[model samples]
Target: MEIKEYFHDSCVYFLNLEHRDDVLKKMSENVQEQSLVKASFGRAILDREKEFPTGLDTDHIGVALPHTDKEHVITPFIAVGVLEHPVSFQLMGGGNVEIEVDIVFMLGVTDPSAQVEVLQQLMEMIQNEELSNKLESAQTKGEVISSLQHFTSLMS
Candidate 1:
């Protein structure tokens, strides 16, 4: 149930790289913050986002979950990138209108069934204001990972 179980430490980052393509750029930034296995990861999520759109507009805030094929992932991971600036993404729940996404949870799931579980866990985390606040304010990789671990553990 823990993100680390699926997402390795190498795959977790703060997203500090640059690129011409926004999606690739973001993923590169996240790679800089999180992993070396990022170019493919970013490309995958960008492609998926273009097709399926992972942006979600909840009662509390708007967020995006960009992910790609499991094969690109060395281990299952949910790389979280907190953008210093929000980006526009289409919402999954309603209209075509976009939302400013401050939090990006990139999921790397090999088993399709695990996708739902990850989504559910992410949804629960987003619903709690305290948890969301913690994630938004997390200044370090350890802080982000620990917070996610604490919440997921308690939920299970």
Candidate 2:
């Protein structure tokens, strides 16, 4: 499925100023409003942070995905959070250093099997330096939606 099909334009956060806990909390709140994710989404984000951290420090840009198990998800959807102000998230690969992430692709995978495809597509998009830079600087909902659509189509 296309990222646009799963991530509606309405769900894109164009002016997110909060960082850390507030960011994650707001994301959880957003999903909680819909049937996509329940209260457990918050728990999962925190739990995932402790286990497999999603922060990425790439040559072009930095990004993060606070993903969780399917059990915490209700409906499948992605929360494309564009932080107007960068947030600090611990890097996953190694090092104790944290990166300032302007973009967050929070995955709500209701089906466990869908996680692999979603991650693979997301990774492909992340690997594109130009695309990653564009996404990092995206300031409008339409821009974010179009970028996600383009990346997903390319991957597919």
How high a TM-score does candidate 2 get? Answer: 0.89
lDDT of 1 by residue, 1-156 (tens): 454376444545554423214744565455535544445666666666767777887776667877667666654667677666667787775457677776777776767788888888888888887777887777877777778777877887
For all predicted structures, in order, the TM-scores are 0.79, 0.89
Q: Per-prediction count of colliding residue pairs?
A: 11, 0
Clash count for candidate 2 is 0
Give the true-structure RMSD of model 1. Answer: 3.4
- Give the number of the best model, judged by TM-score: 2
Evaluate all candidate structures by whole-model CA lDDT and list the values in order.
0.67, 0.79
Consecutive 10-residue window with the lowest summed lDDT within model 2: 13-22
The residue-by-residue lDDT of candidate 2 on 1-156, one tens digit each, is 555577877678755665666787788888888767878789779777867778887787778888888888888888888887788888886667788877888888877777898787777788899787787788788887888788777767
| Candidate 1 residue runs with Cα over 4 Å from true position | 1-4, 7-9, 15-24, 28-40, 93-95
